[model samples]
Target: MAATVAQPTHMTRAKHWNEEVENAYRFQLAGWRDQVEYTGHKGEVTTWPNGLIKKLMRKSDECWYYFNKTRECADKDINKCKLYTY
Candidate 1:
């Protein structure tokens, strides 16, 4: 049997800059709803030395979206991101 994956209980829009918000932005930019969805389609995610996402391949056309070690989600994007919590 396959392992059971827990779905997020609720989601909220990001109002500040944080790791969760940053990750949400990356996944959204890569055209995925979230990491769970990304992993379902792409398997695994790669990260930088400091634990930030290094890159993500877009599922739409197999293009890649690279990210810097620093935070990529700025103040402007905080409001645009939705964070899921289990």
Candidate 2:
């Protein structure tokens, strides 16, 4: 039997820049709702030594989206990213 994948039950637009927002920004930028959905599609994710995501392969094109250890979401993008809660 195939394993079941986890998914988000709730989502909301991010209002500030924090750890959670940073994670959501990366997943959303790669065209997903959050890590749960990303992992559901990609299997697993890569992360940096600091525990931040290192990169993500976009499902639509299979291209990679690399992330810095620091924040990547700009002031303009903060409001555009949707944070998910399960």
Candidate 3:
């Protein structure tokens, strides 16, 4: 007789972002870039873009502020932005 194998009843799934979440983040980044260009002083114009880019890269991982409160709407859906999705 062949031995029978049992499969686990529960499975873990990975979360991912849908098009909406992606577009929101992209729009936020673009707005930040625009702000870097429009708000910086004349002397700081050349350097501010680099600084803003670094800041955006670093802060992009922050869940609370990344989507700028849009996370709430995405909270209910796994395909939307969530803890690990970003």
Candidate 4:
């Protein structure tokens, strides 16, 4: 006779921050920095450095996790924003 093995029947889901929450955290930190706007012959333009985004993401473990997850999701989906590659 063959021995019988027990199989697990229940599974639990892990909790994670959604894109909206992640974006909210990013935008909150981004708002703290002053944006530099320039008006050249072409037209008005605005830009910010990636350093600011990195700094904000590193502020706390939660922030970093959300940022990292965002990047990972973005890698698979083209619709997601690719803010920090690292």
TM-scores vs. true structure, each candidate: 0.85, 0.84, 0.20, 0.21
lDDT of 4 at 29: 44
- Taking the tens digit of each residue's C-alpha lDDT, what string does model 4 give over 1-86? 22332333442321344543344344334332111110111122222343222333322332332233223223223333222211
Best by lDDT: 1
Clashing pairs in 2: none
**lDDT per model vs. reference:** 0.86, 0.83, 0.32, 0.29
Question: Looking at model 2, which ten-residue stretch has the lowest summed lDDT?
Answer: 1-10
Once superposed on the true structure, which residue ranges of model 3 sit more than 4 Å away at CA?
A: 1-16, 32-86
Q: Model 2, residue 59: displacement in angstroms?
A: 1.7
Off by over 4 Å in 4: 1-16, 32-86
Best by TM-score: 1
What lDDT tens digits, residue by residue, belong to model 1 across residues 26-71? Answer: 9999998898878867878998988778999996998999999999
Candidate 2: TM-score? 0.84
In model 1, the clashing pairs are none
Better of 1 and 2 by TM-score: 1
